[model samples]
Target: MNVLSRLWTIAAERRNELVSGVSRKTNAVEAVEDLAAQLKDVDAAVVLIFASPHFDKDKLADALTQNFGATPVIGCTTAGEITPLGYETGTLTGVAFPRLHFRFSSRLITNLSRFSIDDGLRFCREFVSDFGETPGWNSLAILLTDGMCRQEEALLSAMEPGLAPIPILGGSAGDGLDFKQTFVLHEGKFHSDAALLTLLATNFRFTELRFDHFLPTEQRMVVTDADPGRRLVREINAEPAAVEYARAVGCSVDELSPFVFATRPTLVRVGGKYHVRAIQKVEPDDGLSFLCAIDEGLVMTVGQAQDIVAHLDREFTGLKAKHGQPTLVLGFDCMLRRLESELLKKYNAVSELLRQNRVIGFSTYGEQYHGMHVNQTFVGVAFFDPENEEETGGEREK
Candidate 1:
């Protein structure tokens, strides 16, 4: 018999009251424990938790160990966690999908120290191969990795061969406050220095994923120097980098060019659509440095802005049209885009347009989905009954 997956989420922030006179760390752990206990009473095979920056990982781990220790609990820190009802900020909130039944399982890769790029790739392929081989089950992979752990790209890279086309969906967990270091919570506990994998076998069908980022801005430059692994740009067109950028954007070399990138940046047309490669860095001498590589002679285009309200509304609406209303949404937003979204909120129209898609996801240093590179965007998946078209107005977290 095919079973349905029901989900719910709970969150808490360190508002001095939750912690009272206790340590900020203590309050976070307490919030997690309380949330965990609440989730335990439900019949969910999946338990995910996104804690706050002020949380105590050790205590949070103990709390998860105390209750609902068997369910597949996987999550990380978040800029904000989206619940079925509304958005939560500065506190820890969780989306718990329980009660409904679905085949689910979890595994943790604790030995990241031992996780080599080659080996990790092999593991991903193997994982996909094993999952793909499941009989008659439409399977998808939900992966969460330590954002601080430098191996995320390498890990995704390795898994590419195996998961190249499966459309893996997940986000890098972040602590609510900073881009410093974030982790994943598994089995009601916190996991840092580790990665969590959840392979879901569902009765629903997988959809085709087609995504492309912004177009490149004018400025032909080469990546004369680069630190690809670190996401740092070194040089452009064999110049100081900043100079070339200053010329392109007509901006005086300044510290804010990096910040200006969010609004007017270059795009690389990969297949047909434009995608952002990186931003130009303004130097003290009117020179520029780019955040992404600019190999010598690289042709670029200034990406045009496209209003997301209409696009996003249709995206979410179309899903509703096809699957009725989605029971859940799992968003993996790029940290850069989240910053841009803050700007979008200044206007009522933009705010409503953006919020129309209240996707619950943590801002990530980077995001992963079905095996491709994405930046400054929101990526997610919706769970709906293929045959059922009833609107779930009561459902909140996705």
Candidate 2:
């Protein structure tokens, strides 16, 4: 495969001044400086930065605002970053939208645990008020929420109905698998226990992307008992959740670990398509906790794996054919998919696909697409140029 792995490491500055870059510099200031240098010429309206959780976010936020200067900046900590250089840790990746291309506005939702459907409606109203009169242009919302908050489904469900036809895509923030804390940047500061929403009105042609390679098996489990607030399922078909799940997957109860849960995720059908509702972990009482919301009476099927590479190859090829070769794809891939890919020994193949497709993003704690907060799926925005078919700037590493 002709994979240009380190493409994001080389600052890409097109004639239109749309730039995206990744830096592995450990020093917060140095990393921000390097990213800022690539975007210096453009009047940046939106600067999305994803960084390692180890860096002091306060200091990093300071460095970013100092360089970008009050531009509507938003991003979050990540488990692992996806750059043009493939999967990486302890690095910062960013994309800057030049003023000519995008207009940015933001709203921060505080106390997500207390957030409700009403809050979603309110946020939508505020968004409309702030970015009034977005006509003849496409608008997309970028959401960065605390991955540990456990309220993604509710939040997205609430806000989505009101913001009709404006597609939303995002990832939950992570703390490098620690799961202790996560932060989102808004108005040049990092906030925990909150979600940052940014609305972008852009002139660029782009397509929303999401795909998974799991087929539903006949084995089904009904959620007989669950705590929707905590996303814990205590019973499946009136049996202990873990035990029943293991039985369905053809494994012993003792084998129910994070790795096993990741590999043997369950799926729920929505609109005739199966979406993964991945198991997060096994609880002390033998309950199973899920990455997204779970409720009683939900029918979930034991998902069987297919060729991950084959599925992705088709999705990417079809996207390129429909969109005529993307300039880039800002991807939000579910972490469980990464685990499943690694377990299936297809991690490198998946990475090469991402590199070849010019995907720059991170493995999310969860993925948001439209109204659904799904798991084990890859969601992204594929950017296309209406003016030219020639490939734009970005150093190619063979």
**Best model per lDDT:** 2
| Per-model TM against the reference | 0.76, 0.91
Name the weakest run of 10 consecutive residues (lDDT summed) in model 2. 389-398
Q: After superposition, how far is residue 60 of candidate 2 from its true place, in Å?
A: 0.9
For candidate 1, the lDDT comes to: 0.55
Model 2 over residues 5-32: C-alpha lDDT tens digits? Answer: 4443233434255667888899999999
- Residue 301's C-alpha lDDT in candidate 2? 93
Q: Write the per-residue lDDT of candidate 1 for residues 190-267, one digit (tens) a residue.
A: 667788877766544334233333445445445555555555444666666665555566665553543466666666
What stretches of model 2 exceed 4 Å from their correct place? 1-15, 388-398
What is the C-alpha local distance difference test score of each model? 0.55, 0.83
| Model 1 stretches astray by more than 4 angstroms | 1-26, 37-41, 85-87, 110-115, 129-135, 175-177, 187-189, 205-220, 255-259, 278-300, 308-311, 347-358, 386-398
